[model samples]
Target: MPHLLPDTGPQRTLAASNFTYTVGSGLFLTAGVLYFTQAVHLPAAQVGLGLGIAGFFSLAVGIAVGRLADTRGARGVYATTLVIQALATACFIGADSFWPFVLAVCTATAAKAAGLAARSPLIRHYGGDRPQEFRGYLRAVTNVGISLGALLAGWIVQVGTLTAYQLLIIGNAIAFAASAAILVLLPPVEPEPAVDSPRWIALRDRPYLVLTVLDGVMAIQFKVLTVAIPLWIVEATTAPPWLISGTMLLNTVLVIALQVRAGRNVDSPVAGAGAYRRSGMAFLLSCALVSLSAGTPAWAAGTLLLTAVLIHTIGELWHSAAGFEVSFGLAPKHATGQYLGVFGLGAGLAEALGPALLISACITWGRPGWYVVGALFAVTGLAAPLAVRWAQRRQQAGKGHTASRQPPRRICQTSPP
Candidate 1:
């Protein structure tokens, strides 16, 4: 037999997906810093509060957008949303007052939410029944975008001009427009059936719900590693900023290289379950590595922190790929957007809470904060295998019950439970 090659169509779709993610990540990288700078003129707490408000809006609107994507075609919705987001990014370039800043952020947030909702479903549609590999590829592309954006933003900031920052935002807008164009070039996606679909029914699926909860919990660690860890490094260690950047660089590189490999052959529920189990263990290890930073000497802490960060990044890759696989697998075909949207809520909540929670943990527990986070990580990690088993059992039981009710002649063969 001839060696089978991956379908050309799906490969093309993956390229398009990567383009979209790159544009989105670049835009976020540019806009986030600029928004923070504008907020910094205000009281410190107020700045934090403003960001929190924006996050709340993003989460709320993201769920609504997901529902809309299910009703409308993901391609059309995504294209429209990207245009709006680009305009919003432009608006931020000229924003001066607090109210204008708020407006800009809200507009951008809504656009992002819509884009994310559409993007997730589109990936699923393009991937057909095997979403894990596609999602992994998407993430790998997204990580590349993030890395590039970070580099660009750092350079812009180092240039030390508000105009330079504005230029970055302009570049981001261009990227978005370019991404929208690329998406338009792709084949149109068909809308899935929406008949008899229950609104927010995804929220009711127990196993999926558990997975989302665990994702949310794990997100706390991610947030800390990205945000709080840097701050800790600056405060407690003699490490230079370059080291921190290096850690992130290494993370992005590893993700780009390994995600597709890790995601390959993960097409079934059993494989997805296995992925989750491994991801959970990785998370536990990451937590432990990060927690060990407290014991290192100040001179050596940077190297230790960097090592820990590398480990954490690996865990992130595993967990993210697994989470996407399981969640997308469990979602109903017709309600893919809504289900992903609902699932995304946990992440949004975590992003909103992670910074404050981590800071508070540090303040309350002192040096042991790292250990507390580690413990949480281990607990959640260990819970994943149990969760996967439970989900499989539940699905099997449901199948058995359904089979028993059907007439022998009328019974339709389906994919395994």
Candidate 2:
């Protein structure tokens, strides 16, 4: 358990909002497909197409939405997106056909994307000093909420009724609406006056962009575990399918236990970069251990896979921890929302493409594929420190920070989480 929950009002509000929203997400994730197929009569192909379009649309518009947040305030725009989310999800009630379902998916997804792009910046702006530490608390709370919500959804799934499904969908909409209300309670973040940085500054900052890509590569651990590992257990390893559950359980527990601790002391860009490097090594070790499982006896393979999961989760925790620091630290304070929006692109792309990449490497290459994945992680991990340094230097150069000049950051600026 967390030693203590968030202490400040903003922290509490954000945490409650996240918990509420995720619970609804849990219910929807568990049962949405059934509603789409059986209740709405939408074909799987149409659903996939809609989701694909939504994903692209979200990525394309993310920066524009974030720009709007920075120009006005995240509070209003973020809350508006929440309302949009509520309306779109509730729109599911009327979506009994293909076109309606498609529109609903697109609208809901776009709102989610805009909300996601704004979220970190909102936390950074609203959470007082030590926002990163509070962020750690929020991360743990998010997991707890998701676990609870998913458990609740499991009960509804057992009911197997259209009413139960509708309840889940409606509850999601209500949750969004409620969260929007909570967000409305927050004080508005002041828009930076006369921030002259062009909208494309995020793209111009090549080093920061590179760090984002590397972070995306590290994030592939999630997809690899979810998609590749199960297949490996069934096809390549001698371990029984139950080992999959065991590994997953271990991952969740370790993350819940260690994520906050992993984030500790990584408040600075250099420290965060080092943590990213360590995460890469952990990923490498995890991959090596997982690869060793393939040819082992059932007992040994189980042990190896379990160990791999532990290391993988450790990498995941640290990666997330460092990600917050670097992403916030590297961003221009005036354009934080836009930069964060762009930063999210890498993860979005990875999530979209990870399965194909992992399957091709891990399955097609068989034993060697795991090794290749490890090497890829190692390469990316090693690059993190250099990229971070380059970003720091770039920022220094941008602000004309030399030996005799003012430091890069403002003296009055709040420290990053």
Candidate 3:
């Protein structure tokens, strides 16, 4: 916990703000679907469909808003997103039907995506010499905040009343508002100086785009525990129901403890690529282990499942750390917000599509699907180095071109002599 503390003022402020926001996010993540289905009486299918649609539309918002942050100012833009998120969240209480629910969820999702992009420049600016490492620290802080929020939310869920759910929603909105207020304490991060490049430089970077696609593919692993594991435990294995929460608790604790430490070792794009490779292999092995648990005795099944989760969490750490390094390191300093926003599209896509994919590939298809999904991650990890190399080469070439375009220095002649 001492290691999680920031050494400087801006870092401290950002950490505080992030912790506050994620606490609210944790509440929503834990109980938001239930609020729609149980409280509002919306069908479960409608909730999932609305969230999917919202997630899809929200992808573009990040890029647009992020560009605005780079051109205008990140601090104000980011704060505005939080205010918008607060409003949108409050509106959830009023969404009693499908369309209203969709509208409210979409607005909030878009704002959340935009806020992430807008915050990138500030992270780069105040992150000192090792912004990626600092990002890891914030992630650790985020897990702590979310865990706290989830615990509070567990109480709300246990109450099992519409009013209790509404209070949770309201509490989440207030947290968003409070988080924005906390950010006011930080010194403002100025806008990036204007450049003469194309308006959508990140979109135009083909190598970067390719890397984004790969990252998006790999991002499916995030849905494994959230969507697939619980279903698998119930349908395929003889493990107890309590293990669902237990596994999540274990994952959360490990992330909070080791994410920063794992990130420190992955300092460059090459190392990041290597980390990805290792992460993919870990995912593969974990998948195999999980598959073996399906037809086993109760004791063996629980053991295998727990072992798989431990391996998967290690892969998660590596994947997250590698992502931070590659995303930040490859981006141009002046266009950090735009690039990071573009990078976020991958995760956004994953959020929208990964659950369905995982369900089909892993659960529906049964145990063999696990190996197939694991191999996909392994292949994606193996491809990352090649994509990164392509991006690096292009960056170098672009720099060379810029240098060549500079006018030659005027040679002064001694004509007077």
Candidate 1 lDDT over residue span 1-417, tens digit each: 011123657546546546555755664655565545643344445555666788888886766777778888888888888888888877876766567777887787778877887777778777765666867766776776766776777677677576676677778777777777777666767788766535776766788779778878877767766777777766655677677667767877888888777777566656666665566566556555555565567557776777777777777776777677777877767778877887787788898898888877753455677667767866776676677778778767866876787777867788998
Query: What lDDT tens digits, residue by residue, belong to model 2 across residues 1-417?
Result: 545367777777888888788777777766777778766678888876777777776775668788888888888888888899999999998988778877888899889888877776678876676567667777777677766777877787788788887888888899889988988667778877755456677878899889989988888878877788998999898999988768766776777677777787887999988888888898888888888898889999998998888888888888888888898888877787888888888887787778789889887788888888988888888999999999998888877643545456757877899
lDDT of each: 0.70, 0.81, 0.93
Clashing pairs in 1: none
> Native-vs-model 3 lDDT?
0.93
What would the per-residue lDDT of candidate 3 be over residues 165-272, giving only the tens digit for each residue?
999999999999999999999898787777779999999999889888888988999899999999999999999988998889889999999999999989999899
Ranking by lDDT: 3, 2, 1
The runs of at least 3 residues in candidate 1 whose Cα sits more than 4 Å from the true structure, single-residue gaps closed, are 1-14, 20-24, 34-45, 393-417
* Candidate 3 ranges beyond 4 A from true positions: none
Q: How many pairs of residues in model 3 come into backbone collision?
A: 0
As a whole number from 0 to 100, the lDDT of residue 275 in candidate 3 is 91
Better of 1 and 3 by TM-score: 3
Summing lDDT over every window of 10 consecutive residues in candidate 1, give the lowest-scoring window.
1-10
Question: So what's the TM-score on candidate 1?
Answer: 0.86
